[model samples]
Target: MRYSVSEWTKSGSPWVWLNAGAVAICVIMVVGLLGLIAMRGLAHFWPADVMQATYTQGDQSRRIMGELVQQEMVPAEQLRGAGIQVPDGVEEMRRDLLKVGNRDFSSADFVWAMDQGISDKTLPEMIMVAERLEWGNFYGYLREVRESGETVARHDGHAKSPEYLAVWDEFQRRIDRVLEIRDQILTIEKHEIGSINYELERLRLEERSLELEQSTDAEAYAEIEARRAELNADYEVLQQDLIDLYTKINRDSFTAEIADGREVEIDIAKVVRAFLPNKMGTGEKMAHYGVKLWEFLSDEPREANTEGGIFPAIFGTVMMVILMSVLVTPFGVIAAVYLREYATQGFITRLIRIAVNNLAGVPSIVYGVFGLGFFVYFLGGSIDDLFFPEAKPAPTFGTGGLMWASITLALLTVPVVIVATEEGLARIPRSVREGSLALGATKFETLMKVVLPMASPAMMTGVILAIARAAGEVAPLMLVGVVKLAPSLPLDGNYPFLHLDQKFMHLGFHIYDVGFQSPNVEAARPLVYATAFLLVVVIALLNFSAIAIRNHLREKYKALEM
Candidate 1:
């Protein structure tokens, strides 16, 4: 009988072939998508060069080259004097900047340094001559990467050339030495100023005391006047030293000159590490782990002289996530228990079911708006009027911040927990309950000891799902706790142990920042991808853990499946 249907279907249409084709196409699309992303995002870690027409206006194309660019004008000037023909026009017209694209040397037209020199244009000439001409990216750089130190793309064989690395080391060393020397000089100048001020103060006090004394002795007055004169002279010298120090510190600004269309302009900084090879992008190493997290946080304080630290954001996010979890778990578990165990499938139960299901579909932004109006304005405003009359906006618990974010997320996820727990309870056979009842156990006892335990695994799944949704979600939190930058983390040793009303930072928001709002989009690109991947991983880890727990519970109860 089954053979009849199977045979008919087999002859009617090639189902297997259709299915195979569908699967093949699906696989192809998936692979294509993954490959595309990989090519763009993971291909920036290696070295490549740029080749272009000698004219910038000719073609906006890139060519990969295998040379590094360092600005050492000394040798270039020397070579020019030797009648090296100075290769002026070629170096000047940087049509084809060098770069490594897709992480590796994607194409190979690069042999030696371009013969920009009229003659004797060897690699050494490029390195040593330090061309008076501009240093520009052919593709952009001769390093193994497109980024300074961070690895941009993977599988592209971009890395720092040994020569470039040496140059970087020397350059950095020189800068550090110069900075140290300058700092030492500044410190000495400051000490001199302090000493002078102190002496001046002493001399002024002596003069004041001398004037107050009705001393007929001319010697005492003469001594006081002489000391005052000496102090004045010292103050003049110190003031001059101070001005010089200020000028020196402020004047000698460092700049990295790169090639412009016609001439060279100072680029502010030369990233030799940009010439180094990296398979991943994480900013400069010293910047990352060099105890410079504060520097990174405060680097872009919104304005040029602005100051900010992501510590507050980091703290706020952690607090919001943890608080949201804590607030939602108990309420969700209780609701699920009542629905799964005590409630019957009557009109009331159905209504509750409908309501919970509807709640899950509600727009999170609506919740944020509601929270701001009702919780912040109505409730919190009332509280402020009552107790914190002096501090009108203080005690902002119900306001649009971490507290509201946690609450909104918790509300949004309650339905998920309810559904999961209900399913889990239903999976337990009625026989188990009947047996418990027959043994004289009450409904409450049966639910507590039997149904609830069995349903916990399902509840965990719901919790995990809720956590994933909450953690990665930027929309609701954006209206609630998300902020551009916070000076400190929410979990600081501030007065309040848990500042629910404080603005916080989340990883999702960070993705938005790097990808869209960051000043240097190309520079921050790898960070954005890495942050996104990390968030995905976090969600996956939570869900996988829940699944594992569910599996364990299933195994534990397998023998008792009535």
Candidate 2:
């Protein structure tokens, strides 16, 4: 009744080919997706040329200047559907998306211009693009530079003028000096003044504590007052220095002729970088691209999370994952060791394993809710009451923070660690355990010195798995420590260095915030892609590091386990 061998071969070969084709197709799709993401994300930093064009729609005509971001073709009906008129016999139309910055003046940072409406498109050699600190990007023609209400240099609508070059050089020099002064101001404000404030708060708390203890010694109060006065004098001096620096930074200003023919004045200190991308040669553009990339990586976010870097988010994500691994490994391993090596092999143990497996599949939000109520409110409140009673009502640990976030994720991923470690322990030969016992070694010694070392690779596998799950987790972190914008990092130069109670930023939440919650969607889109790509890269790097260590351990213990 069975099929002949020839028939079976024909059928089996077809199925094998079909399976291979499916695998190949999947690989292609995955590669294409990653390539698209990388292309879109990395292009955000490239210096794009500025285009000056005349745009006309119906009876309206105006000149527009900006970066030509993209071009596309669409059916004429689509244009008409949007209330735009299509010429007779036109079946399709071309449109361009322009990044018309100068958000302060323009209603939108980006606009779509139909090919039928645009005329006299030209890449202007003199058009300048200014990356600003507050108003997104500014695209216009450089007019002149001013200092203290007097004209220092005027462009005269000339690109090769000595006056223009002089002004540009002076502007560059002033920008360097302004940046230096700005750094000084930040250091004074954030670190110097910050330390003084912390000391003052500690003193106030000390005074409160003394009052609570009924120790109202006049000499103690006088000493505290004297110290406070010294700190106040130091703060006052730093504040005056900051004021002087700000005045110096604001001394120089530049005028730009916008697309509407109106000249606008912008303070030099407000500009992050100003460059004529249209005029830049290959080398210049490459250099500019490098600078922009570095800035994107190193700087802090500005303009509603639409501009600048994501350094804080990157730091937070990595730190949280590391902390989670540190907290999860020992507990997960110990639990697995006890269950597999010590506990009676029975129905209850099997039921416990099933429960652990179910915990892994439970929704992450459930974990967040549990962490919020149990860790943040119950346990954290208790700890705060006991250790940090002085900072009461302020809720030091009694709110979402780094420690709770890390622990929550550890709890979420612990099941995977336990399962992996248990599987590993089961793989070891039974005779190995019995041999150690027969050789007069204690069970603990055998497990620690021999069994655990052999199981190290599997333990690492568990950690790697835990990290992968924990690093990309956003829903739970939203209720835990992650914020749209953290004012300061959890780890800083302040006392204790590692501030577990402080809130932190995460790249996942950053992508979500910029992509979905940003006020300037167009400006935030590129950043979303860039941040997503960076997050993927970070997770990959962390996993690869763990994998490398796991491989080394596996190699080290291969012979012993065999």
Candidate 3:
């Protein structure tokens, strides 16, 4: 039987339907947003066929070679306004953004061309796309391979010629050799020499500390000098090794014929990978895509974070959130326990609850400013002055760093934890406490054994919320610690293992820097989306871990609640 609208409202069915509808809409929007991000971001890794075409504008016909990045229909008026001569009868025109990525040879990495002017478009098997260490991708044909300034192999005009295949084979072998050498150089510099440098710095600091303390220890000075000598010897050896590796890596060079029919010599050291998209089989393409995706996740960023992977940013974001959770949970729980269990329900307590609620509403940037001022400058400076006087003139803790950023986020998210924990505490049946007390248990023991165990799921819920918020936060991190690029990870093989005093990268900040601060907006656009999707995934992973714990806790304490 159909109910009247008033009757349905009276029965609360309308409100239920409304609430369900709202929830459904929210879920749909969120899924759609994630889908859009995934589509735009993930497609960047796939190898698209590079097109060779003649682009004619007015009287000048030029050869254009690049991947077709985006296509859009634009009003003829807009095209004409941009000084392009649109045909008179055309009301709208299709424009294609081609990623013509010989950045060193071209004025732009990406150029928009009217579809009408694009002629003789073909996916030529000979077209090679060279992913580079700098200046972006190079779309060209491999013309010659040179070793130590001597011509090793030269490509003929024919694509399938034996000479061309031999040249390609030689190029691949040289690339493999260069890559192996590059890895050795990186290892020597980043780890082996890095350790030596770290020890040398520590020695210097020790020497300074002794000087500050007015120590006359002759043996100490001698020891420091001997250590310094050893380090210098190690550095020299590594330096020589580095020189050799560089010489080897820079030995091979290749000449490529770009779209404009100009031959440019590119050192093998600068080329990251070279692939012919048109010639690649499906399996090869898949393998290439896998490697690219892995690099995006595992490698260090290059070219102002517009290219390369965001591993550092990912590491920093996760580390900060973990630290924030650890710092916030106990303090928040203690505060909540004192408020809900120990304190008298009076005006003062009410005032505190009000204050805690209000703290949640404060602007995140305000938290950032406060963190920069108090946590970074004031507290950190005081610590540095007292404990690290030897490292004077150079502020150690008195700067934006991992520890300060973590603490700042802890403070920012504490209110959420406190409120959630207090609610959890309030939900416990008083009889449970009374029963434990009646059985000769102390208030603390009863609270710990019975009440807390039952309330842990709520505490975890709070922690989950805190993690969700802290992980995605970028503004406060910018002030407190996050940098555009961190040369080294805060956590590494160095002594103490974790260097909380070091500034670190965050995915949110990476996205911001790539999306807005990048010099190449077109190049960075897909990266921004990809990074955003990864950020979401990271946050979800953190939240899911907390949720899993919460679920376990809930299960463990289900009987008591019943």
Candidate 4:
């Protein structure tokens, strides 16, 4: 009554194993793809350091300015002491008294000191800039320079003030600082180096002329030598002062310069003034200059591709889909033609049917490899020789671009069209074909005038399916046309504008580059998700267009009955 081990195994059968294998594969593929896409496309928005930086530039006062915290808040008593009349507003006038306790009065530069991107969450701080380093906002700069006990003018932010000429007078002070003119003529001894070379040269020439005139007296010669020695000693000491001046050149001496047709300078003090969020103009630069904390969630592409009109990737994908559709349609319809019209149901026809169906069941990626090897290298190379001899060695039709990408995708999706067209051809009633032949129509005419017209809708359905598959395919195009960046589009303003030979950008490739291939992974995530969504929408649009065209073709043949 017991069964043998061999008999038990045979009773279980192979179909069970096949079905289980198919389900397992489907689950693994779907789960793996979704996981990979989400992990790369939704994690982080911005880099870390930008979120934490306070002062992006330096703080210097001599040539630069800090925030004007307390410029001109002279009291009425002080004005009266200086014999100046106070304005009518008196104490009611706005004061530059930026105090520490009150949170309402704010300067423009405090929010900039935070250096973070837009946040609706917390209230920002107000910081006052001090005229000297010690008085400036504590965290506004990386470091500060303490001022010397020298006279300095401050702006009152008002139109009528004696210190209004301070900015212009700064250059004058710099000129005087350079010479220290008073230091040279100590008791007409002139032993300091204060632009005294001119006086020394004049005296030297005078002594030489005196020597040439008459028998130069010993007393006169001694007097001339003594005066020349004093000037020489003065020039020598001035040379030492010039050496000291070089050591003091920090941000204090930075001067505005003009160069060949460009303004190539940056004022650090101006940047600090512009840093406060309240002062910025409403533009993109204001959104993220240094860094934004939300970059971790931002979906921006790497480099942002500011050049206004280069959408090469989108163009390439569309071009490839069109080319693939054109190539696959004819081959699929013709093969269906041979099978239905001419190929008799012999052993060879059955074997061909079996082979065609088997090809449809084969994995699409395998077709991609076959296309790369056969169409790109063998058939493509052959055509390049016979028709495109000028582009030798390079193999014009065989390299990566719109042409090869299209051809490769066509080969990959051809089986789908073939199967679909065969179904359409099979759906035709035998009576219709017989009647066409009875009416003295040729078999080819019956196909051209009747059979194909009747089957156009079904034929279109296959095209729609092929396009949908090709539009979202990133792997096959990776081998054929997808590149990280293309300087120019495949189509542009030139002779025969559609340049199929150029490498193309693709949304799929963009997703890969932004999510996986980028230098800053966290900063590109949101952009990657948005891009992925765009790719999905694009594929749907293509399918919808194909469906519309198919419906039109179907309507054109509605009266032709099978």
Model number with the top TM-score: 3
Please provide, for model 3 over 1-562, each residue's C-alpha lDDT reduced to its tens digit, 9 standing for 90 to 100: 9888899789998889999999999999999999999999999999999999999988999999999999999998888888899777989999999999988888999999989999998888878888899999989899899988899999857266788878888888888888899899999999999999899999999999999999999999999999999999989999999998888889999998998888899999998888889999999999999999999999999988888899999999999998999999999999999999999999999999999999998989999999999998999999999999999889999999999999999999999999999999889999989999999999999989999999999999999999998898888888999999998999998889999999999999999999999999999999999999999999999999999999999999999987
Model 1 lDDT vs. the true structure? 0.54
Root-mean-square deviation of Cα positions for candidate 3 versus the true structure, in angstroms:
1.1
Q: Whole-model Cα lDDT per candidate?
A: 0.54, 0.90, 0.93, 0.56
lDDT of 1 by residue, 501-538 (tens): 66777767877876788654444564555445545655
Best candidate, lDDT-wise? Answer: 3
What is the TM-score (0 to 1) of candidate 4? 0.50
Off by over 4 Å in 3: 1-5
- At residue 381, give the lDDT of candidate 1: 73
Model 1's TM-score against the true structure:
0.58
Ranking by TM-score: 3, 2, 1, 4
